[model samples]
Target: MTTQTAKNKAMTERLVEWDKKHYFHPTTPLKEQQAKGPAHIFTHGKGIHVTDVYGKEFLDGVSSLWNVNVGYGRQELADAAREQMMTLAYGSSFFNNSHDVVIRLSQKLASMAPGDLNVSFFTSGGSESNESAIKIVRHYWKMKGQPERKKIIALERSYHGVTMGATSATGVPEFKNMITAIAPDFLHALPHQTECELGDSSAPGYERSIRGIIEKEGPETIAGVILEPVQGVGGIQIPPEGYLQAVRQLCDEYGILMMTDEVITGFGRTGKMFGVEHWEVVPDLMSVAKGITSGYIQLGAVMMTDRLRDELADLSDNVFFHGFTYSGHPTACAVALKNIEIIENERLVDNAKQMEQELWKGLNYLQDTHKIAAKPRAIGLMGGIELLADPDNGTTFEPSTFAAPAVVEECAKRNLILRPLIFGGLNVIAIAPPLIVDKQDIETIIATLSDSIQAFEQRVM
Candidate 1:
């Protein structure tokens, strides 16, 4: 090899060694990583593609953890971060203090948020956002002299975050099982039970639905209901028509707060500024992250209705007593502001909506070409296809088969990156490319995934 090539190889090898020795990855198998080294050492990204340290490039099908809505390598976001850092590297939101960028971002979010969600409490990311929301609702009840209303009801198969409260609120068994001891007062109900949520006692599984649980546990003791507008980590499960509306009505009838976790579906991931807008349902509280800055910076916020904020302000005699040091970091806020401006100026939301049609066509094609592909689902750019051993009979693959991960690995071999959502006995392949992707990009991703699925079929069938 040439001298430059040799130098690059040496650097890659050294970095790999250091990573195997010291790096502790999240949501990874420690023993496997230590034994085999990292799967890919990404060095840089531009648009919807990321390049590894070994100079191999791949299309990022999952948007680097379902963020990066505006894609990667945007000079505008970089400049915004730099300018804000130069002006004010860090600013805390403590003691009721604030900064210009934070103030501006809050107002922008308020304007963009659904209904009267005009107030924002900032955090560093999704977990913090969910944690703050949980605390806020519980604290609200306490301030209202009903501290017994501390129970939070989440939906089964939902993925909130990894923080203590978020983890407890998560309905994914694997996540909650990670720790033997989790926070209390977090209950999970059957997901997407529209009739049951609407108080249809005759519906199948009604006793396990949110409404049923509230009634069984005493609605007076329930503080709020938390659910994702579009379940992300739980196999991109889209709620049936009127599902969200039914949940909102149930919460209203029971005097409980309805909170939607928009961490994944926010910022146009679902063809709208916020996913709840599709159903015209206004949640009392909403937690958002990820695309708020298109993953350029870590930032999140818990937004509340004006009425709720006013009530909390009136009820509390002391400080709220919760916030992060970087609650409203000026640099992060600046990056977010610029990132949002780019999204609006470029009309990426419209692009995502337009691309949904193309994605749907591709998903259908995959189902038609592959006998194992079934239950195709898509909303905007977020979509998933279930892999079954026998589609006609709805038979799932054995857990030990690891079918989804195997197909995803085949896609990776074809220079494409995809995520397998195997949590909760699911064998689903999630497809959520960046909003910047076009028809050609969608075609490439679908074609690659088809070949990968075929390879898996040949292996198993």
Candidate 2:
């Protein structure tokens, strides 16, 4: 064989070897992956694009697992890490002792977060952040002398995290099947898509339905309700008009704490500083990560309003009793501080607002010509393209057929990485480019996705 042929064979063999040995991927069928061998390997990234080991570049439409909002290879972030490491690598947030970086970051977050949510409890990632929030809400109720109000009401298809406690909060059945008797006090409300899928007006009816579920569940037994402003993994399902406001009203009336999981929509990913800002709703507690340090360092936080914090404080013996070893690590906090500075200085949040409009328009333009597209939802830099078996009837393609997955694979082949969201058997291709993505990059993503869907249609149909 020629030299080029030899190189290709060597690369393919390496991948096969990797598959045979060390790699246990998440949310994937192990047996199927073992049969298929190693998947695509990203070697490097610049701006909104990543290159594989084979030197093929692909648009990073998913932004490295929905983080990396500031994009890749930011030298300033690297410098911030280096500087912090040289000074103080790590420190515990235990007892009354803390680092300057951690203190400053907490104060900054308090100021930026909506309402009186001034307390910041740091965690290792989104999962832990959510886990902490769960613990805090439960503990707060206990402090209020209502330990019976331990139940948490979350929406179906809502994703909190993966830790045992946070996983229990996730309403998606697939994530909870293996763990039996997970959490006793958890209840799931209907999601916003119920009315939309049933071909009814989704605005007022959807809001009323969710409120009815909360009422049926008896708000007295519930401690809190957790929801994503825009469901990320749940096919980017945006709630209809007055949905969030109505939920807020119901929560207030029932004395239930409102928790917003901003793990995927915080720090300018949603064109604003946070996703809840879009609806002008103030959450009693907010869980944030991902863009906290632009994914430069491992950090997640739970912000609590003064009301909840005061409740914890009022109890003389209230321990609250939860923390991670790496909570408020000094170096991570320093990096986060610098990352926030970059975001503010570069005006990336404002850029996301503009890019969001451009991206929505671009995707809508494709929908006019692409028959497979349905229910295109776009807000800020986050969006989703629904793939339908019958666009006119809004019927979904079967999961076994894997039409959405096929489209994703085809897009990958054409050097564009897109994620397929499967919820209620509907396929939604989630599009969340980095906040730094430009008009040219948006054009490329749209063209690539449109072509991929067309190619899949030609082959599958």
Candidate 3:
């Protein structure tokens, strides 16, 4: 056979063999998928678009699982990584020793983080970052001689991470059913469902419900209250006015540490550097990842207030015994340092702020035109369009009906990659394009999504 024929044959064989073995995808039913065969094979990515092995291009509507804030195929980020690897690729952060890049990135993060979150703890990703925060909170109270203060309050529909510890902290039920029992003492509070037709009454009612949970659990036993400033996996539930402030006050009154998981909302995904900044509510500890290195390299960080660090310092044996081998990998840190610099230099955050208005305007237009759309919520660059089976009655379709999945499939057909909210029957189309996406790309995504929703409506009807 000729060289060209040989390459094509090899590619086809690889796909068939991959289906036969080698891929066990996350968040997918193994038996069903393996029987169906291998999914789309992504060949390359560049600036908010990805091409498959067959060269069909799709707009990265969800920014490749909500990272890639600076978009794809960034040469500067690649260069930074190359330079760091050439110098020093790996280092253990176990001892008192540290590297220049790690120290520099730590200082930069401390400075940019909201409030007095001065101490930094590095992890490989969001799950580990959140896991570290949980350990720190428990350890902080133990050092303070409140060993029984171990209860943690998380919000319903909130997603912290998927580690055994962090997964327990997540309030979605689907993550809980199959897994072994998570640690006890973790309580879930009511989530803010502003998009629900129940109206303004639901906001105060939800806050009161959370307050009741805290009181019943006894404030002394509660170590911290962990929440997402804007619940990402929970259909992009944005808290209403006074909700975050009320929670802050409640935590203060009960002496509970307020932990904000900004893994998705940090580093300009929400226009603001940190989601809590939008509410002006300071958190005791914050967990961040995703855009930290613009998805060029893996890195997550936990930022805690100086007071919390000091409290831990006061105890002779209060060391946080948890970390990953790549906790502060020099290459990752160097890439992140350059990433942040690039974000600042190019004013991507401000660009996100500008594009956010246009994106929301386009989505709102869809809500007005499409009968399936119940409500649309937009905050900065993060937006969600909740689709209802009966918009007139505000009734949601059953999950088994797979309405959202159908819509998602339609979106994929239109070359738009969208993610479905794992919680609730509400069909939410989340849009958080890369901060570097220009107006033309934004328009393309909006138009494609609008067309996809229309096509979905036609089929479902």
C-alpha RMSD of candidate 2: 3.3
TM-score of each: 0.99, 0.93, 0.94
Candidates in order have lDDT scores of: 0.95, 0.85, 0.84
Quote the lDDT for 32 in model 3. Answer: 72
- lDDT by residue (354-430, candidate 1, tens digit) is 99999999999999999999999999999999999999998999999999999999999999999999998899999
lDDT of 2 by residue, 158-235 (tens): 888889888898977778986776877777777764443232444454443556555566666788888999889888
* RMSD in Å for all candidates: 0.7, 3.3, 2.9
Candidate closest to the true structure, highest lDDT? 1
lDDT string for model 3 (1-461, tens) is 99987897688767967765987788787887777765567879998899987678999888887889998998999999999999998888886768888999999999898789988999988999999999889988888889999988898888888898799999888888769788788888777533221323344554445566666777789999899999999889889876778778778877889899999999998888889988898899999999999888899999999998887777856346777899889999999999999889998888888888888888888888888875787776788888888889988877776777778778899888987774755578888888997778878887888888898888776
**What would the TM-score be for candidate 2 when compared with the true structure?**
0.93
Candidate 2 clashing pairs, residues 3+ apart or interchain: none
lDDT of 2 at 276: 91
Residue 331 displacement (Å), model 2: 1.7
Q: Model 2 off-target regions past 4 Å?
A: 1-16, 193-210
RMSD of 3: 2.9
Better of 1 and 2 by lDDT: 1
